[model samples]
Target: MLGLLSESEAREVEQVVAAYPEIKSELNAMEDALTQYAVAKGIPMPADLPGRIIRRLETLDKDVPPGSTTPPQTDSGSGPILPILGFLLITALAGAIYFWFQTDELQENLNTTQTELQQLQVNCDQIQDSLEQIVLSLAVLRSEGNQTFIMRGLPDKNPGAVANVYYNTQAQQAFLDIRELPPPPAGQQYQLWGIGASGVPQSMDVFNIPQGDGINFIPVPYLADVSVFAVSLEPAGGSPSPTDVHMISG
Candidate 1:
């Protein structure tokens, strides 16, 4: 069809097409497809194309010797122009659909980034609070009248947990340094207790572990004549009496 075949090959193709009507029909369909492709790609074609083809047919008839089989050329009309316009419309619709999806994806990504930034801010605030607690605890420990005591974990419950209690008897200031303790159970917190000489437990402070890893330096109420410092796992706000004693120091 593209004039790529030799003379002998062209003759053979012509004979085959003549013998098979289905082959001729398929070749005609291929010519129409090529014409549509050319128009869609903006390839220019002369308006007098039919006239040029008729003249070429006349020349071919004269050039070919007698008794030689001549292959017929398929005529492709202005059928390709309408299909080219349809192709352009489909392309425009596809582009619009792609743009809508891209916009939705970008919006989702922006939402994710904003959520991550909010989490980061919350982490930063927690870090600041922890730092303030550490500074206050350090000041209390370095004071002149400060007394330090080591609270050992109960063997039955938490043998590895330990706490360092710092108290200033003159200033009535106290801080509990949690050196090694596992996180509390869900919906629970650690409660600090001050046991006086009378053997009654007084609730000093109740606190929770922050989200990330860090040493907790918590300030607690200092009781006068307190002989023992203890910690217990209790409900969120703490229990009046020691409900679950885990660590104790005198």
Candidate 2:
């Protein structure tokens, strides 16, 4: 009804509204709100508003002679109440449409900005995690009198599996860094084993695999006369000896 929308734009809006029936309900709600507001304000709509205006124009035409094209004189009195009420209602509807369009545009922009910001936050978190891993690895490497061990999985079944161990004999500090290993089953767990010179697999500790790039610091009970280190999937608490074959060992 207003000239705010072009013909094509109005058609597009109509098509969109037709595609989503929910928009009809929203328009209905707006109409109801306006009706309720008019009722509350005790505003009366003239029943024969248009018919009365037309009849007055016809009377004026009859009063003027047929050949005479004289314009009607302006009445120096208060304007009709119906016209004033119609103007106020149209002005209110126009204002509502203006705000509605403005709010819709702002909401779309807000959604787009939020998506971009969330992506940026994910990237920042990944970068922070990598930096923390680097710092931890550097700290281990820079430790005094450190020893390193390479852990490899069984060649036949798990050729690609590998891990690393960092140990310092003087300070008696140890850490297991799992570089390549798959996640275990729900009930299964990974156990670290320290092999002694007499070919005995010592149960070091039981731990679950870390989620991301993380190192599990394990205690070193005996660093002396250690020959090999290994990891195996065992029951929850772990076994005294290597009940199952080693998944990764050196």
Clashes of 1: 0
Residue range 157-217, candidate 2, lDDT tens digits = 4677877888777767777877787877777778888877788888877876666655544
Clashing pairs in 2: none
Q: Report the C-alpha lDDT of model 1 over 1-250, residue by residue, as the tens digit.
A: 4133346544444444443344445545644554575467444444554354345334445655666444333345443443343334434433553464466667768989999999999999988988886787667778998899889999999999988888889888887777888999988989988888788998888976545556566777778988788889999888878899999995
| Distance from true location, Cα of 8 in model 2, Å | 37
- lDDT, candidate 2, at 152: 84
Question: What TM-score does structure 1 among the candidates reach?
Answer: 0.51
Stretches of candidate 2 off by over 4 Å are: 1-85, 104-119, 197-199, 210-225, 247-250
Q: lDDT: which candidate is best? A: 1
Give the TM-score comparing model 2 with the true structure, all chains together. 0.55
